[model samples]
Target: MLLVYFLLWVIFNGSFTLEICVFGLVIAGVLLGFSCRFMDYSLAKERKIYRHIFGFCGYCVLLVKEIVKANFGAMHLILTQREEIEPVLVTFHSDLKTQVGKVLLANAITLTPGTITVTLEDSEYRVHCLDRDLAEGLNESEFARYIRKLEEEKQVRKG
Candidate 1:
């Protein structure tokens, strides 16, 4: 965190000198100490974040891929199969343990082109799909799986 703070300080200042470096180091130290004292920040949390960084990056890549695929699917439905379009509302339950995981799942569904999360209460998700095909496998999607994996990683660390 100190390194990140110092880098940000240098970047924002637009120039670096010996005096500036010394000042930035002191400021970064102060900020890091303040966070540790007031914000419950610790090196353990930082290590945990570092461990999950790759998983988060993979999830992001998967999200982009899903978004692109959904875009094409939506386009095809709009351009060639407009007459057969059937919008549907589907409800499904997820086993994701954390609120963050559930919210991420909901947002990922909504971010796709052909689907929107109508409601998310507890573990149940109500999503509106542009077509029935889009609703297929909606309950156990890759998004949900990735989020479950992330949640499991947290549990594993705790255990």
Candidate 2:
């Protein structure tokens, strides 16, 4: 996580100056220290954590692709076939167990152009979609499945 913060800081700064690097290191260290209190420090040494980190990075890339696709689809619908759009509220049960996983999924859904996460109650998510087809894959999406798998792995590690 500190590495992630440092990389983001470096990227945002867009420079390799010694002063910026030192500042980023100090800030990231403080943030990581504060975050450690709320997180399971024991997991820091676990292989499962590394696996989840890599999986999450891949998930982020997948989310960006989905966002692009949704944007084009929504734009096309608005420009050429607005009449065919049947806005609907769809409710689905999410398989993700962790709060972080569930929140990530909800935010990802909301980030897509044609969908909004209306509510999240327990494992159930209510989403408003601009089109029915956009909501159809919510239940069977790879995002939920991957998060579920990650949660399962985490539970197994704990046990």
Candidate 3:
């Protein structure tokens, strides 16, 4: 999946320098070769990876929108005499059970504004949020469930 992304990106935004293109293609081929062994290009695996990439892309778009809203929220708080800011740390346990899922959770947390994943101890995630509302929302559910499900979905296709 990563190899496919690199190849497409190079093709789309390639600078048209033959030497650079050659280097990039070679690197992409090598990475693809290595990943293919692990990825085991079965139909189910391929479908799962495709779905994950699509979902991640969609998640990223939503995250961008949330970031814009958070920016506005932050700005409003800054402009107002009232303090809407309430820094807090929240912890929650999850069932991701894989490094990939944990990494995705960390990344998704980072992608959302005003929230940062501070640690992953076992299945527990310690998140630092800029305010109480974000903290409360985060604490209310297993926000990383989708990421965990994505990882588990792939594990079923493992060779």
TM-score top scorer: 1
Which residues of candidate 1, in runs, are more than 4 Å off?
16-19
Comparison by lDDT, 2 against 3, better one:
2
How does candidate 1 score on lDDT? 0.94
Q: What TM-score would you give candidate 1 relative to the actual structure?
A: 0.86
Error of 1 at 124 (Å): 1.4
Q: Can you list the residue pairs that collide in candidate 1?
A: none
Query: Which stretches in model 2 have alpha-carbon errors above 4 Å?
Result: 1-51
lDDT of 2 by residue, 67-130 (tens): 9999999888789945577999999997777899999899989999999999999989999999
Candidate 3 steric clashes = 0
Order the candidates by TM-score, highest first — what do you get?
Answer: 1, 2, 3
Q: Residue-wise lDDT of candidate 1 within 83-154, one digit each (tens)?
A: 678999999999999999999999999999999999999999999999999999987999999999889988
Model 3 poorest 10 in a row by lDDT: 137-146
Candidate that scores best on lDDT: 1
**Cα error, candidate 3, residue 154 (Å):** 3.2
Better of 1 and 2 by lDDT: 1
In candidate 1, residue 34 scores what lDDT?
95
Candidate 1's displacement at residue 77, Å, is 1.6
